[model samples]
Target: MNNSLQDTLALVGRILLAWLFVPAGFGKIAGFSGAVGYATSVGLPLPEVGVAVGLLIELVGGLMLLVGFMTRPAAVLLAFFTLVASFFFHAYWSLPADQAMMQQLMFNKNIAISGGLLAFAAFGAGRWSLDAKRQRV
Candidate 1:
């Protein structure tokens, strides 16, 4: 593909992926008490600390990915987080019938997000990214 097309694709990918996390981080922030309760219910260690860290990764790391700043590291960290979330909260489990489908959907979504993050890690931030500019310098 030509440079223009590649650049456009990268921009689109970054925007779409970054947009996904913004709401998640905002949700964690907006619903801090609920998040803490949920985390504790899920048996996540240090629920408050975990929620804070998760919020930071989803908000800051996600924004960095959007702008292609520290793209590689951000993507990797987000990918790891996504994978862990999938296993912890979204994995197929013996839950009540009403909630089982929702859990399945969340699991699938996290898996897909992880795939996207891995792709970004492999491809770098593209021509329009800070990583690319740094490379040029």
Candidate 2:
């Protein structure tokens, strides 16, 4: 594809990826106690701290991805974060039969998202991004 097309695709990908994370981060902030409760229920050590870190990563890392600022690092961070979260939040193997299907779907979805993020980390943000602009300066 042409450079313009590639850049536009990258921009769109970043926007789509960020869409899932940014809103989730805000939701975590809005429902902090509930999030902590959920984390605790999941047996996460230091549930509050985990929630805080998740909030930061989802919000800040998501914004960084949307803007394509430090895209590689942000993508890498988000990718790993998503993978870890999938194991905790979407543990299909631990669920009963009916619930297992849904959890499996969610787990697969997160895996796909992580794959996209890893692609961004490996390739970069493209010409429409802040990372690209920074390179030019």
Candidate 3:
């Protein structure tokens, strides 16, 4: 209803979404070998490169989102990344019964996250963002 509230929501939303990826990126890099191994297990070709690209996208794109800089592009990139990850790595349908439930949950969660990213891309970062500041100048 109000600009202030709208801006606050945008900033908080950005922070909330960014947290999901920031620690994950840090952890992936911190345990680089483990991430690569997991990627390999998922049958991604060039697992090392995949892990590196994922780490870069999560870390850099996530930070850009947090600061509301390049917000639309960053959100779109992450959204695409999430969709691919959900289908490829978290494909619950291909798993055994016991593992299927967990994978399915993860897959669903990723899909929901992608929806949020898409919304952000449509709305643009609100007035609290660097994008907004640049617009004023």
Candidate 4:
């Protein structure tokens, strides 16, 4: 494929992926106490700090991905963050049987999302990105 087409595809992909994270981060901010509570309930130490870091990763990292600025690093950060989240929030094996299926599904989804993020980190944001612009300078 032409570089132009590839770049467009990368831009669109970044936008689509960021769509999931940006709003999620905003929602968490809106419900900060609730998020902290949820994090605590899931057994993470320092729930407040966890929620704060979560907001930064989801909101700031997501915006960086959306704009294709420092895309690979942002993607790498998000990938690690999501993987940790899956373990902490979706510990299906420890849950009761009835809730296990849904938790398992969520766990799998986080893994899939992290996989995509890793792929993006490897492939980069293409020619349309700020990273590309910097490379040309």
Candidate with the greatest lDDT versus the true structure = 2
Task: Give the per-residue Cα lDDT of candidate 3 at 73.
Answer: 98
**Which has the higher TM-score value, candidate number 1 or candidate number 3?**
3
Q: State the TM-score for model 4.
A: 0.94
Reference-based TM-score of each model: 0.91, 0.98, 0.97, 0.94
lDDT head-to-head 1 vs 4, winner: 4
Ranked candidates, highest TM-score first: 2, 3, 4, 1
Clash count in backbone of candidate 3: 0
lDDT of 3 by residue, 6-79 (tens): 99999999999999988888988899999999888989889999889999999998998999999999999999
Better model by lDDT, 2 or 3? 2
Against the hidden true structure, what lDDT does model 3 obtain? Answer: 0.93
Instruction: State model 4's lDDT.
Output: 0.93
Error of 4 at 11 (Å): 1.4
Report the C-alpha lDDT of model 2 over 1-137, residue by residue, as the tens digit: 99999999999999999999999999999999999999999888899999999999999999999999999999999999999999998999998998999999999999999999999999999999999999999
Misplaced by over 4 Å in model 1 are none
Point out where model 4 deviates above 4 Å.
none
TM match of model 2 to true structure: 0.98
Q: After superposition, how far is residue 85 of candidate 2 from its true place, in Å?
A: 0.5
lDDT of 4 by residue, 1-137 (tens): 99889989999989988998899899999999999999999999899999999999999999999988999999999999999999999999999999999999999999998998898999999888888899999
